[model samples]
Target chain A: MAAVQSDDPGLTPRSTMSWWFRREARIAPYLYISPFFLLFLVFGVFTVAFTAWVSLHDWHIFDTAAGGGTFVGLDNYARLLNDARFWRSATNTFSILLMSTIPQMLLALVLAELLNDRRLRGPHIFRSGLLIPNITSVVAITIVFQSLFGRHYGLINVALDFIGLDMVNWTSSRIGSHFAIATMVNWQWTGYNTLIFLAAMQSIPSDLIEAARVDGAGRIKRWWKITVPLLRPTILFATVLSVIGNFQLFAQPLLFAPGVGSMGGNDQQFLTILLYLYNMAFRQFQFGYASAIAWMLVLLTAVAALMVYAGVGYLNRRENRSALEVERMRERANARQEAGA
Target chain B: MTNVDAVKAQSAAGPTPGNERQAPTFKPNKRRFSWANNWHYLVLTVALFISVFPFYWMFVVGSNTNADVAQVPPRITPGPNFIENATNAMNAVPFLRSLLNTFIVAGTVTVSAVFFGTLAGFAFAKMQFRGNKALMAFVIATMMIPLQQLGLIPLYMLMDRFGWVGQLRAVIVPALVTGFAVFWMRQVIATSVHDELLEAGRVDGCATFGLFRHVVIPSVRSGAAVLGMFTFLFMWNDFLWPLVVLGGNQDAHTIQIALRNMSQTYYADYALVLAGTFMSLIPLIIVFVIFARQMIAGVMEGAVKG
Candidate 1:
């Protein structure tokens, strides 16, 4: 702001009330936005950087008493890289992420499409009912699911026995454990995504669909051609969100078993990367190596997110570009008619 | 027929013309939507059934003995032992205390995050300031970092130094103002609050803050409400940090930690474990039930784009 102080009493150096007001106006926004930056720096950014530094040291979780940990150069990182357990956890994380997320996205989309009907009146029940699972704490849902997926006497096993089918040991076996954990993740999240997609679908002007209907487009064709194309942004949003959230999958896997220090399983079948970090830091008291694992998680999440963005972005643009071609043809026809006139 | 006769016919069809979803402008025939020929409700029914089944099963198993849950048919009904199991569950772990503690922390975090988010969001959306874009970018960057995981060890030590370990403040302070909250509110403000309104507020010599309080707040009330609901849900369900910092404080645990402790301690006591889990779900279930409509509309606000 320009300082236009004058001989006037309000603007004068002795009584700079008006000048102060102008200055305040100029500076108030920074004041408003500072809280997030301040808190995030102290808590979020600083802590992340601190984790990296800690990874370079020989730090025990409880070694804060006697002048803290010793500075060991790069040993923790080396151990983390060469460790089979870390690789297992990383592989488990990605596998669960894919298994859970792909089915999740498809199911949420299909459910959203079904609920997007204009004739579906007073759907608050369905919408809210679907969201109940999402609202439940991961701890609660994982435990409940673990029960249903129980081996011998569990309800699922009983059902399978009644049908003369083989019952699966959910937690003990690798595929069974991953499937059970994924189901817990899916049940919790699908409803919330449905609402998000419903919102996105609602905004896709109905007349566009009506236009396609009039043009003799089949039901599935119209949906694939028009609705899917318009829903690009929301699809990308949900995909990227799932990438970030499920990649850092911790709570469900942590609480999937019954024991205190279970580590996903005896053989670490369902051990997520974050769960491994927790086990390392808390259970084993290896804070330095745990911090290294944490850094690796950040890198993996970043890579997954970028890949989703690029891949989804390309898919969206490819189809939307076709629509743009049709628009260009129409515009060319209109231009020719105007020239003749 | 006269206009009066037309109105009479409409009234007879439905007691009130207000019952009609849309006014008959272009389409002469007012088509009433029926459930017939629509298989969508079938999909919805199955979906709702799946969604509700887990909780129902939780209730059933929770109200029965471990042996009853193990019965051949698999007990699917709520039993009379719920209150008894609840008492045992409470005694075993700090369920009730954790519920109260979770409420306090989640409530405080929601209020502070919303207020700060609105202030910052309004500034970024409507008001001009130096380094505005840079600061906004910084906030967005913060969202991408799984800072909870990234900063886990350091934060543990930090909380210990501040004498906040085993205290609610350790969990509460770190999450006082989140990046997503700021970004969400900014989207709400940018899309919903119009420039003409802000200009009018400015013409009346309203300060920047006044413009936000008067013009922006009223317009973004629904968005604010939605953000509050989301914030509360996330904070309520937050497990990792609360588990870490408050690990030592068994009595001051959040419901998630309490549930974890209960299920592990009474590992074979499925009834007791499930009872604790069911108790923890009660608050959020109630919130979801009551605010269903508003929450739906709020998600429809389109934070992804706006």
Candidate 2:
């Protein structure tokens, strides 16, 4: 045993200096990653805890009161639960999130499929073009979109008029406002998501598709049976990412709802949670109340993200696109083709 | 210090030719577009047009007179008023200064994020220390925090206390380190830097830092550059936080803030504002032109590999 122990390079008994050197090699990783943890502790972990703590108090930035404000012990949270604007804003957030995310994700998958075409010409140009909107400031895009979605003589309205359609009040009405703002979010993100999906799609081994084709499957059939299932993990990851980002939905709605005091609309029609939080903290100086809203927003975002995970799981069960099911689908497809022939 | 000198000398010596080594082979596309692939190209072209038309429209409105912008058909073609509108935009807002401020913020943020992210990414990828998995998961878990929106109040207070309020540092520092960049670099380094290479470095008496500086840095150069591109774009385009912190300090306003100033007007000068928007897109457009290939490869790598 002693001979074996000495034979092992790492465990060999050596001088204290050698042992210390070995110890550092193990601990050096901590030194490497400490900066992130330090910042995470202060800026990330500490801020979250502090935000929660602040939400429990009656803190006001201007009052400069002692002890930062009285401890309300869930009073702020209680108020938030009853706040009408909060509910309205919550609904708006959810609706806009759905409106933006679903279409954007669908469009991205389609575009990615197109971009992943092996024989596509100038493919690099198209990929880069798609990402331009993402790289351009989201705020800047919102500003441009705000102009484009103008009430009259705006590009969209003019386009609508030319198409023999009535131009809806984009900034004034609820659905109109949500649709316009959602369009901005959709346009800005779809391309980036397309690239992500494209990358994932490209990595899907050609053997899988070729095998499906050899099994007498058409292109669309092969894609549905094989590619879609394989891309599920990447899709879920992309969805969670979009949910986290879209839930914030601040600058777009704020800038889009022009002349409405940045309340998302005159009636707060499309007011998101973050915008509402901004108003509560910055406009009303209700830091405590705003913190509560923020806390709730985070929780809801987490719930939404987790629900996506579970929802996809539920979809798997309901769709039941197991290999057996796919085989059945392929057999049905082949039968139809034979009958048609 | 000696490690730094050694790296300088080694890199100055340049890469050693390795014609003997087996490299991964790729079949290059030698075929151009054929008639059968016309529809695919057409679809991509249409998508490309829609993707890029917004910038074109921005230019159209920017270079045109406001009267031309308000026309029924709207001026689809570029007008000759670009110089005038640009002059108006520059005069109306401190755009030049704000542009300079944006460069500083984005530049500093990119450098810091890339450097620190590369360092930590190397450690995470190669190191076999305790709690590596959990710490990495923790890093990833924090990505969902949405720091800009959630921590607004406390961050403001912290900045206020630190006397960084309305200073560019307020924008630069908090953004210097992000969970995404760290996580991204981690993935990049993990896949790109092979274990055998690090083993070789270690056998050559390279310490942990030495391995990182030499073996890791060169191997992960493209990844670092990609991370830097993303970080730069993110920092350059950052809005809400800078708007909140730099609200009081116009001297420190970023391009986004300046553009916001033009955008939030009562009458809304479409020509001037769009001109400002047009101006802001130029730098990024230039960057895209230069690094589009690298950026595309970078995106694919991060997505597919990770």
Candidate 3:
């Protein structure tokens, strides 16, 4: 009976097939990971394509004019490229980025250095203190900042006045408004960057610093020669993140700046690209045009990121070359000294 | 080799003479207390005050009437009108429903996120399944995809088709399995959970589910707690999705939606709005303190490698 069962083709097929399935069980992991990709394809990829398509057509949500969407190819792109509002928003975005990210990263690095000092106690408390702004809801922080920046009885201006400065028309003036918004953004983000930088700094070996110190290097020299060079990767990472974040600046600026739903100020000074896109899409119902702007923004961001990558790479290569030269010279000098001795 | 040693020898001798430089054994000095050590403390203390002062000031403003709040130089002290302001805010919107809705949505998201995130994490980390590497890479790449601006419209449409519009699940359900939680859980599991233990359970005839529950779940309890807390926090403070879907339905609003509506319509009522805002922060602050360790660890863990 056993021999007959073993010789049966049906049983043989079933057993070998099951073994193959078991051997190819790696497919289950793909299945496990497929849900995100599937959702992203439908929700992310398709929508992006649809948005681009819609941007090309002059379509209304209500479809009032001739069943909606006259296929006027490239006109939207032409207009968006030439649009003053688009240029203005891009300028505002960069301006705010400069105002917020530059000082923010610098201050964060200094704070991180202090935190990294061996003598400093209760690093946890300092770490927690740095995280408050990160964890606070953007809404709550915006509302509070709005109240504090109020022109008449605002706490910030009042404090400024107490220090012999004029009561700045923070929201009414374009630059003032941008600065106000930038201040809030910096406050909310500096701590986050500090934590990141601090973590990066901690990973740097203390032995390097000790070696530098033994070589008679001062704090400043050590920072420049060892710390800054080693932290370049972290800086590049933080910068790219900051760039992306700056382009997507919405909530705080939207709240702090005048004009409902982010028209920027009276002068459109703080109207970010995202805010402009939002207005175009939702407020004006120009889905097609908004999509073009979004795609353009993405392209621009990618280009900017690529440029930074190239610059960082070039600088690193140059530094490495010079460092190698220095090593070679030092080695030759050591050989001569050893031969003379 | 001689050349290399000579170079090293020269470099070592370049500073402080070899004997002085080699005195790495120890340098003992009297522990003189300097203000520099306390300087960091002072700076951090000031930052902490700035961080906490705004919330305290919100309470102070909340207790005052509108006139009192608008007074020049600002009222630094609390007034006696907190009850009136709170009552006005409560009456303005269905605050209780919002609280309940927020809690339920956050709770559901937390539970689902922890369960799915943990399961997916374990599978990716431990299972000897095919395509594991590709799946892990896909999950990591999803973190870089800027979903906020990119996926908003399509996601909204999806929710619409599913008839989840104006429902809290519209926000909660899609977020149950995200790139962040999945990656985090996987990392935690890889470090904490051992493969041998799972094998041992299997050898003992433990079913897959039984192995997960009895062996895997207990091991990753702390990781799950951290994920759960953050999931709850994000849901609680989520503005745009709920704002878009539930804009017209005041009864279906969360605290943020209700608060935004109040502020949008009644920006002049600084006292009442501040009261509502202050009330909104209470639950989060309380939760944060209760889960302080996990919260801190979660932030550190996420930032450490990144």
Top model by TM-score, which number? Answer: 2
lDDT of 1 by residue, A111-207 (tens): 8888887667768888888877877888888889888888877888888989999998888888888888889889988998888888888887665
For all candidates in order, the CA lDDT equals 0.82, 0.81, 0.73
Instruction: Report the lDDT tens digits of candidate 3 across residue range B64-124.
Output: 9878777666788999999999889888878878989999888988887788788778778
Best by DockQ: 1
- Chain B TM-score per candidate, please: 0.84, 0.85, 0.86
* lDDT measured at residue B100 in model 3 versus the true structure, 0 to 100: 91
Model 1 alpha-carbon drift over 4 Å, by segment: A1-17, A205-208, A313-341, B1-36, B191-219, B303-306
Model 3 bad stretches (over 4 Å) = A1-31, A63-68, A257-261, A321-341, B1-33, B207-210
Off by over 4 Å in 2: A1-20, A63-65, A211-218, A327-341, B1-37
Residue pairs in collision within model 2: none
Model 2, CA-based lDDT: 0.81
CA shift of B69, model 2, Å: 1.2
Residues A215-296 of candidate 3 have per-residue lDDT tens digits of 5667767677777777888888887888887788776666664345368776786788887877786678776677788777
Model 2 reproduced share of reference interface contacts: 0.67
In terms of lDDT, the poorest run of 10 residues in model 3 chain A is A1-10
- Reference-based lDDT, residue A146, model 2: 80
What is the alpha-carbon interface RMSD for each candidate?
Answer: 3.5, 4.9, 4.5
